[model samples]
Target: MSETMTIAPEQKAATGNSNKMLFAMVGIGLMCALLIVLTYEGTKPIIAKNKAAALEQAIFKVLPGTMTTAGYYWDGNAFSPLKGTEAEGQRVYAGFSESGTLTGFALPAVGLGYAGEIRVLYGYDPAQEALVGFYVLESKETPGLGDKIEKDPAFLANFEALSVAVGTDGNSLKNEITYAKSGEKQNAWEVDGITGATISSKAVTEALSTSTAEWVPRLYEAKERFKPQTQSHE
Candidate 1:
């Protein structure tokens, strides 16, 4: 008779244990992936709500006198009430006063900073041709140096009524915002740069300049569309 082939008892046990360990590892990985997906799904709505709330607050802050706000989508032709996620092109948030009059527009702009991109929200008063308010939305700037763009009171003053008058062409800024040397601001459109944070300060100026160059004319042309609805006097 042929010798019977046999796996040693310990060998068989080791093999069984190895297979069990592999299965356990695979099971754990799948469980981890499932948990991650579940967690993302569960928290998505809350995260969205928080973001929306923050943006609303920022809109009010940047566009002073705003008691209410509405989002609009600019499709290179007109501003329309946002439908679904069609926030493509230039998105604008119109701020309205308690009396239901349109106050100003909150526009987002981003530019390169010392460390990275600096994002800002600014309020534009089409009537005044000025930037009335400003708030830093996000920045990855140097701690003490570049961060001054957000913290410096002197820098903040620049946006209180920075001029962005349309040029005679009616399609471009008469004078794009420029960073003036400390204490040398000579015009309404000049911004005084932070002494130590020139790059970051310049970034904000450039961001607004570029954004307004593209949007101001369009918005001015569509100003009537932004007016609050009034009951017919008839």
Candidate 2:
């Protein structure tokens, strides 16, 4: 005769309670997930709008003397004005002076920084064939040290008129942008690196170099297109 192993009344009650608790936890998790998705969906447009506004302000800051700006998108062969709210694809900002003269272009570039990717907007003056200004759009660089790339006066001055002249080939930079030790910058195209922010400074240098190499020649060749449009009075 074998004795049957039956759960005690107390044991059965505890097991039931455990199952209920587990189910409750799963339900709570599902509810939390749904809330998160809903909140994200609701805020998406607001976030995008804020970012767009910030970028517009950055364009003006990077290209001084700009009274107005227009967005241009490069579509492989040429550039065209961006349609309303059209933000996708390769794009640039053409800043104009109060007289409607094309002042300079605010070009955005990104590169690996000391802590993460650094995004910057820099002004390219087609007439001067040089970089006129710079501003950090986004950065994850270390504080105090790497942040000096954006704060240090000496470093910021590097981009005031850094040369990015087109070469004889008419398609590439004459001298690639580079960074040098603090107080050691020798050329107009060289950036002065921060004493303790080498990586951040170098990242900005590379980003500007890469961006200018691709955009300078194209902007120079098609600069007339960026001029303000004139209306015809019939």
Candidate 3:
């Protein structure tokens, strides 16, 4: 071999240009990617807070009352994160009005539906001792069929003021939440079934019963848990 190798003029120029372009492209791509990640991370907390605030506003609008986070709890605990409570402990969120009265509750419950898990929110009217309203958080029911329970106005109206009367036995509803296959409703606990959606109707019934039915009594027990520090003027 010779002492040194010669570089072709055309090949040298092409190689130099290619290396510069490749490095420039890589640098631009990395900057773009970093900017995207930073933007996502920056907006994450704001998005979460907006969602939480919206949900809280919705809950208050459905259930009667004005509130401060002071009286509300998170997760499943009976009260909010008070002193000495761990920030990461079992979550519980309860709500109360300004006057220290037990107004209502926002309970999240789950039930098995014809399609899959049915998540719902039941608003209990403590004054009336009845379910004032309900909202389906989520479900996987068949469209136009089982899912109508979450949207149809007629179906939604049926649940208003539907009191789950705890019977003397204490294990059954004052009137078992049943679908009148043939007769007129004799109690609030009953409703005309979803006409053709038996499983879906029953799924709503189950979620409501498990969520509202059981929690109402427990609420009364913890009624004072959310009492505010009142220093009002006469």
Candidate that scores best on TM-score: 1
Cα miss at 36, model 3 (Å)? 7.7
Ranking by TM-score: 1, 2, 3
Per-model lDDT:
0.84, 0.84, 0.64
Tell how far residue 63 is off in model 3, in angstroms: 1.3
Q: Name the 10 consecutive residues with the lowest summed lDDT in model 2.
A: 225-234
Q: Write the per-residue lDDT of candidate 1 for residues 1-80, one digit (tens) a residue.
A: 77569846665334548878999999999999999999999999898778778888988888889877777878767787
Question: Going through the candidates in order, what is the number of backbone clashes in each?
Answer: 0, 0, 12
Candidate 3 residue 233 C-alpha distance from true site, Å: 28
Q: Give the worst 10-residue stretch by lDDT in candidate 3.
A: 84-93
TM-score of each: 0.81, 0.76, 0.65
For model 2, which pairs clash?
Answer: none
lDDT of 2 by residue, 58-167 (tens): 88888889877788888889987776455432778888898999998988899899889999889999889889989998898888899998899989988889999889
- How well does candidate 1 score on lDDT at residue 16? 48
In candidate 1, position 107 carries an lDDT of 91
